[model samples]
Structure formats: C-alpha cells, structure tokens
Target: MLPLSLLNTAKGHPILVELKTGAHCHPKSPTLCEYIDQRSTVDRVTYNGHLHSCDNWMNINLHEVICTSAGGDKFWRLAEVYIRGSTIKYLRLPDQIIDIVREDREFRERRETLSGNGTGRGGRGGGSGGRGGYNNNRGGRGGGGAPRGRGGFSKQQN
Candidate 1:
C-alpha cells in the first residue's frame, strides 16, 4: 500500500483514483469512493503522476484528470494518484515499482500453493513479466531501447 504523504500531492479538482485493495478488501462490493462514504475507508488518490492527496481541489490542476468517486461522502485522503492528462493519456509509473508489486503478488500465490491452498490442481498460467528481456539485447527480436544506444529507434533485422 502507498504511504499517506504521496496522496497529499493531489489536492485539486480532476483527480484520477486507482483503488487498489488488499486481499481482504472487496473489489466487487461498493467502490472505494462508496466504501469510504459508506464505511469510511481510506482511499488512495493518484493525480499528475503523484501519489498524494491535496488539501483542496483548487490547489492542483483540475483539467487533467478523469476523476471518479465511488461513494458520496468521506474524508479519505489521497493515497496514490497518477495524472495523465484531461483523461490520463498514460500513467508513467516507475518500472521498478510495477515490478515489485507484481513480484509480491506472485510470491503470495506461490505461498498459497505451497501451503496446499489449492485442491492439488494445476494453477493458472504464471510469469506475466512484461518487457523483461528488452533491456538486454539491443538488436535481434527483443529490441526495445535502441540500436546505437543514443535514444533512437534501431533498424529491425529481417
């Protein structure tokens, strides 16, 4: 879970909130906003690539987020906010952060499997590592960064 300080950065109108709940947290039930209003749950609000809630809506730029509120009334401070644009064209999350989160989730699944949490049946597909080997080889097939390493597209070898 993200820290409280990160949410403070989103203190204005037009905020994008990505409600990530824990294992006990219900994603099907009332949305985070609604949950907050109904049960006063702490919500993580992300805006402008920052994970923090602002004091007021007027403090930040309101014209950049695709805001959404689940519940009606709640004092849930921002926990994490990623601002893209008027609709968050693209959320620029650090690769390391994404990897860590994915790895943690994978670990939990492995633990469950080892503890016989499943019915001895084969589990779902594993290894969803995105763009992993792209950083290694600069050419061939998995070319991602570039060829010359000068920040430009490398010619693909047929």
Candidate 2:
C-alpha cells in the first residue's frame, strides 16, 4: 500500500508529520503535530495546537510545513502548522492504523475476488470485448476468424 493510501485509511487518527525544513538538525526544537480527522485532507489541514487559533479554529497549508512531531514527545504542539508537501520527509502513524489499512485492503480484495473482477485483467469474460477489449476486425483470433490481412494482398495485378 502507498503512504497516501495508508494515511487515507488512518483518517481520524493522530499523526506525526516530519518535515524537511531542516529542523531535525536541531535536536531540541519542537516540530508540528496534528490530530488526523476528516478535515486532515492535504492542501488544507485543520488542527489544534499551541499556535493561537482564530475563532477557536485554524487552517494550514500542507506545503508550508517544515517539520512535525508525534507521540508523547513535547518537542512539538498540536497547533495548526502548514508545510509544503515537498518539504515533508515522512509521516508517523499509529501501529493500529497499519492493521486497519491492511484489513480494509483485504476486505476489498475479497469483495473483488467474489465478483470475479479482482484479477486486474481488463476486458469482459465470455469473449465479448470487455471494457477496453479490441473489437476491430483485425483478424487476429477471437471474434469471427475472418481471413488474415485486409483483403489478402492480391498479386499486384501484374
């Protein structure tokens, strides 16, 4: 599973995002943190932390953040922090989130298997030109075994 996919599945969970702002160079600085939720979507992040909040709320850009910290470490607070996606070095998620994502993936796989469409193979079954199946009269195989090329290459008429 991809990192983003795992994050999606970890919605509503607490996450520690480490930014590439070069803050890690300082071993005593606090990073940014967020309580993952539905609003945790990228581009715009809604969170609560030490930063002052306007109207008891804060919205941050995902591309402005430099670094973030998670877990019991007080190096950082939950205040709203904005970090550029490119500046993000990595994200720390709870172990349970991994399990949750795994279960969800397995469930989807099972569902697709039960429906006979989980093989990832394109086209339909009965050989009727499924989704992206080729239907043109190429004369390859399937369909009507019409001759080979477009009109056999006649002897050039001499």
Candidate 3:
C-alpha cells in the first residue's frame, strides 16, 4: 500500500514511476499495461515525470513525461499522462524530499517555541494542534518550556 501523505508531498516533484512489468515484482504472474508493453516481452518501462496531482485512488497526473523502454534502450516523451495507481509497481522520489519534509516540521517546531502564547495549538488561530500538542495549563505568553504546537503558525511579536 502507498502512503498517500508521502505521495502528496511528491507533488510538483520529479518521480520515476515504474509500471507493473510482466509480473516481475509479483514473481507468480506478470501484469503489464498494454499501452506500454505492447511488445509483450519488454522487461521494464519507466516514466520520468513531474507529478502534477493525484486522487484518492492513488491515480496520478504527470506532466513532461519521458518514457523509457526496457534496459534503458529506447525513449519517448509525452507532454502529460495519467496513470492508474493499480498499474504502478513503485514510485521513486528524490532524495531531498525527506529533508524537505523534515525542514518544514522543524520550522513549525521552532515557530512553536517562539509563539510564546500558551493559548492552544496554533494558539492564536485555534487550529488542530499537531501531534499531541494539547496542554491545558501553562503560565502565559513568553514563558519557558512552551508546549510544542501551542504557538505553531502564530506570528511572533518581538
């Protein structure tokens, strides 16, 4: 099963989408997309593209796609393509994506440290506190040991 959150994070990012190729991953049987595997014996086909969007079913829309045939021999390009999630064997995301997500999380944590108002999660906004971010009683704004998520998203006034 694919992690939809991670897939969403991949939006506007480059991805290598390997379609189900002749049961290679399955071992018992090969299921291939007729459009890409018309030859019937092609071992693999991959699409290098920028992810545009995805639906609840994990179906994806890609733009600026480049299709590569088995063993990296032949290549063709498409302006855009839509891929059904079921036909996808796996998706390869860039190494930096993990770092990007980590940075975003860290930035929020730092903001929480700065918000200083012990109101609630995103204290100023009454937002859904992120990940166990509820503390009923804290002294007030500018206090130490500020709970994480309490001040998240609120602008700090220095």
- lDDT of the candidates, in the order given: 0.36, 0.41, 0.64
Query: What does candidate 2's lDDT look like per residue over 9-29, in tens digits?
Result: 655555555544333222222
Model 3 segments more than 4 A misplaced: 22-38, 109-158
Instruction: Report the candidate with higher lDDT, 1 versus 2.
Output: 2
Q: Which residue ranges in model 2 land beyond 4 Å of their true spot?
A: 21-78, 118-158
Error of 2 at 22 (Å): 3.6
* lDDT (10s digit) by residue, model 1, range 48-105: 3334333332222233333333333333333343332232222334445545656776
What value does the lDDT take at residue 158 in candidate 3?
Answer: 100
TM-score of 3: 0.57
TM-score, one value per model: 0.26, 0.45, 0.57
| Deviation (Å) of 79 in candidate 3 | 0.8
Query: What CA RMSD would candidate 3 show?
Result: 9.5
| Cα lDDT, model 2, residue 19 | 45
Error of 2 at 68 (Å): 7.5
- Give per-candidate clash totals: 27, 17, 3
| Candidate 3 local lDDT, residue 12 | 98
Candidate 1: where is the Cα deviation over 4 Å? 1-49, 53-86, 119-158
lDDT of 3: 0.64
